[model samples]
Target: MTLDLDPLRSGLHHRHDRVLIAAVAGGDTAHRTYGAPEAADAEIGSVSKGLTGLLYQDAVDRGEVTPETTLGEALDRPEGAYAQATLGSLATHASGLPPQPPYGGPRTMLRRTWRMWRHGENPYGDSVDQLLDEAADVRLGKPRFVYSNLGFALLGAALARTAGTSYERLLLARVAEPLGMTGVSVPSTPRCLGPTALTGRSKGGRPHEPWTGEAIGPAGGVRATAADLAALLGGLIERRAPGISALDPAADAPGASRIGAAWLTTRTGDASVTWHNGRTGGFASWVGVDRDAGVGLALVSATAASLDRDGFAGLARLRAEADRC
Candidate 1:
């Protein structure tokens, strides 16, 4: 059975400046575009973390590192809260790290938001070194299923250090290049300034810069097209990616879902849906796979508002429809 994505297409156009939706089922692929051409790139936000998880697992497969490898050992840093955290813990969001660094207080966040909306400033300006410095004093709490961007940033950094390369290079070599996801990349500058990049907007309707820089790249910095995302998801579903173990359940998350190296899985009827959603200052993205149905889907929008609710609802419905086929 073919999937009808018209409702998703309409909703995306109404809520975003540009949108891309793609789906793959039984080896047949299809897509819909609105307000943007298929090649236009949009930030994938935290969805990048899911890719980072793939990279980490690839490293594990090569024996470059192990899931039990501690962050301190991988990064060669002195022992501390973050150092004691294992790679598996970080990937599963059980490292006890906070959602963000402590330096950005409420006032700072407000100022950054204003600058982003008014001047199109890239709010994540800290360099990797600077991020490490900020993370030095972070007091980790007890390990649990707490989502932490800082933890992911550290995980990406550790993975890169283990391979003696940069995160972007590692990802490109191990994941993007292998999967034929040519449009997936970490932009060195504000993507909003690029000709093929879509203009992003704040939820309040103010134009904002597309996310850039390496500070948040691992946690949420990927810019990609719908085709690239569909290819990546398809690779995961087909077991073509090297780190297929990343999709295996690692820990429990909220709502009875299982977390597996940044991918979250929840039962939808007799099938399981593994998915991740992302949002940045000017973009939102969602990617999911219904393994039982042999289907994958990706949605990207040029908007800052969270698309988690709509994305989950749509993907669940799509999965149900695919099952009926």
Candidate 2:
């Protein structure tokens, strides 16, 4: 089906070299790809966390865990500040954890920054064991809304450990397959990135290395095609997705008035947009749903730049169409 996504395209501002837009209204879904094949995969960054949120809720339903379940219990880690944080707290970014693993010294920071700027190298390449080691000696502050890659990394590990599987395997079995997102994957190594993987670019158009890491898979390592993400959103809109309740606001979040797991619900006009955006050193993506209008929209760009504004604009356009229908 042909979709007039001109409003969405205009919002792009010609900043993206490769773009994909998809929207679903009522029972009709459409997707369009520019500068890339429909099956090409791009990093979805923190959108992985939003998907993990669904997994967390699904685990709860299966009695595999609870929101109150401590990371220590699931991961079998020793009692400590990091391990003691609840799964729910991590899901909602209320774990009092820092954004990423804290690295001391200016030298480390400068080196990391230089590598990213010069080589477009991935800053995250740690394994699950490495991530756990870093969390071991950490201290946590009072729980509040603080986006934490570290917290999500551990959350995914904990969930996997409790399920006697790896994070990628668990995701495939529980989330992707169920939602008809076969193209979605959390590649742990560069070799795992299939031929359909699209190389990402910086705003200035410099090529970037794909961000791949076992530990980061739960937080920001997801890659998917336009169709896969649209399917995910459609499943959520139809209340057929596992952990559909995760879309409901459960706690306060920054920017958005409330958050459900990793999804942020923000008031825009007469609708509430439950959404999450992702940015990596290479790619950017946004996915949102206007539940009241039964519309879901998603955009993926193979460039390390912002797509949130365009995504919202696209979603608003789709919602308007739905209203008219």
Candidate 3:
């Protein structure tokens, strides 16, 4: 069956800044853009967690770790909440970890917000050591589907430590390089950003800080173009990416969706759409695939206007449109 691209194209044009939409079917690929077409780098927020989940699965397959391996065994931190949490639980957001670190209190959040608006400060400046220190007092809650950025952060750290490298390098070597995703990266500093990197803005029209740094890279520090993200999604759909099974649904989630390692899965007729979305202070992103339809899509926008909701809606519409084709 043929694939329809008009719905996605129109969707991108209507409600986003510096938008990019990409889709792939079989060996054919297409891209559409609006506003800053040249802006290829935008923060991908928590979608980074999905990629991190893939990396964790790869590590497990290679025997570098195991699903049963506890965070304490992996990170060598035998005390506190993370100690008893397993790698599988962390990747699936079933680790009973909170959403953020204890140090991210109200006062710290306010300061971070101020810095974001005033100085474009990188809110995630704390090093991995600092993150672990801050997490020392954290108490694990009942194990269920609680999305935890801190859980992903610690998972990435443990994986990196197991490989004796950083998360950025690990992602580059294992995922990006393998998939030819040259545009996917974690910028070390603001100065390292590309010329076309998007400037993230706040809801109040003020420019906010770009989310970067090592501590948060695993949770939400990726930057990539629509083309790159489309390729990644296609790779997963075609089973060209290692550990692609990580995208398979493992448990039930909110909104009648199923939770995979880090992806959300929903059904549209006979097609299963597995997706993950991202949002930073200034950018939003969504990537998904309908393997049965041989279609995969990626969307990125420079505006931070809660694109997650819009993205899901758009994808559902796009899926319906594709069905008609």
Which is the leading candidate under TM-score?
2
**How far is 71's C-alpha from truth in model 2 (Å)?**
0.9
Report lDDT per candidate: 0.81, 0.86, 0.79
Q: Write the per-residue lDDT of candidate 3 for residues 66-137, one digit (tens) a residue.
A: 989988888899975678999999988888998877776653755876776676566676788888988987
Local error of candidate 2 at residue 218 (angstroms):
0.7
**Residue 282's C-alpha lDDT in candidate 3?**
77
Off by over 4 Å in 2: 103-110
Per-model tally of clashing residue pairs = 0, 0, 0
The positional error of residue 220 in candidate 3, measured at the CA in angstroms, is 0.6
Candidate RMSDs in order: 2.5, 1.8, 2.6
Report how far residue 198 has shifted in candidate 2, in Å: 0.7
Tens digits of per-residue lDDT for model 1 on 28-62?
67776678886887888899999998998888989
Please, what are the lDDT tens digits per residue for candidate 2 over residues 1-325?
A: 2457656766686878588778888668877777888788889888999899999999998999999999989998865458789999999999988887754454354576588879898877778987787668777978998889888989999999999999999999999999999898898889999998998888778888888999999999988888888889889889888988888999988775799888899999888999999988878889999888888888889988898888888788887776677
Worst 10 residues of 1 by lDDT: 101-110
